[model samples]
Target: MNSIRFTKWLFSTLLFISVAVSSCQKDDNVKSMDSNKSIAAADSASTMGVINTPGNFLAGKGTLKITIEDSTYTFDAATDSVAFINVHSGDSKYFGITAINKAHTMSFGISSVGFAATNVNSKVAGSQFLFKLDEKNPVVQYTLTKYGGKDDSGKISIEKYNNDNLIAKGTFFTFLAKDDKVNSPFYRVEGSFELQLK
Candidate 1:
């Protein structure tokens, strides 16, 4: 009888131990799941940083500040933006600034296949990345090449480009330009802006 009681007690103790262990394992799983959710929430909050917060740019020496409606084309225009790295329309890396009405499009580009982003120098006569401008009026195209006595020139700086935000800041000093349908002159196209990429 004593042996029987001992066996019964042992079985009860084992059952209790099993239940306690199972409960602990369940709690651990729940804690892990909660941690994962918190991490996901944090990641979502930092995506692309901010939007519509257009930065400020000061037109330097030779550039003219052209204003249209409410925004200035040279600075603080809602149309200014940065592009993804090597992820452009067909697989190109570019930075562009445009007029609010989408009438003017100025872009800088470099072929990323065998080029380093750090080597993009507009000041160099034969820069790896070239500057090109396209405007309405049946969309006249202008390049940074030299004209009568002026040449397009500038510099680009990537302040911070990451999962959080992208910033391609720079200054430009271009000149009187001529194309098939456009004859435009620039005193200097110098400005610097900081904002996230679209």
Candidate 2:
């Protein structure tokens, strides 16, 4: 009876040890899988010009899309370019963004002051929108100016801004008047842009 009891105790001990070892291995596997997932997420964000951490900026090509009246124009990183320029003269600072098509005949531009990450979802001050078509012959142009009459109104809302990266994503809607006149013919313009400042 004593020997039998001893054997039973030994068997129970072995069983307990086996389960503990297996549980530890399973937990290790779960930890490893979590680590791999984190790495994958970081890689994905970097590819899209997004940084998960604060104060880090990633530079990447951007896209722009604008619709004038019923005609839509799309410009991508390929065969086109988006430029963001910071102009500073005297005590004034201006932010300018331009998107040009591959053919170089069509372009859209914006100029604003006090446009920054802090101004997200707010209309920028001194904002102006300009659209140019057929740059070669006479340059057909439309504009939305800040102080224009009620008919010539527009707003630019910054949806996303990464100050460290100087990357801005925004949406704009405007009634662009020919020759910047309130009584002139106008076209409804709507667009979105993602730009990396130079």
- Which lDDT values do the candidates have, in the order given? 0.30, 0.50
Q: Which ten residues in a row have the lowest lDDT in candidate 1?
A: 55-64
Q: What TM value does model 1 have?
A: 0.32
- Candidate with top TM-score is 2
Clashing pairs in 2: none
Q: For each candidate, what TM-score against the reference?
A: 0.32, 0.54
Let me know the TM-score candidate 2 reaches against the reference structure. 0.54
- Please, what are the lDDT tens digits per residue for candidate 2 over residues 1-198? 653353234333323322222222222133344553354355543343322233222223567778886888776633454544444445655444555554555665554544456455533322223345444657666655433555345667777776554477888776665664446676667888775533
Candidate 2 deviant stretches above 4 angstroms: 1-60, 122-138, 145-148, 163-166, 196-198
Clashes of 2: 0
> What are the C-alpha RMSDs, in order, of all predicted structures?
26.4, 26.8
lDDT of 1 at 24: 22
lDDT digits (tens) for residues 27-76 of candidate 1: 21333445533433354321332111133111111121332223334423
- Per-candidate clashes, comma-separated: 4, 0
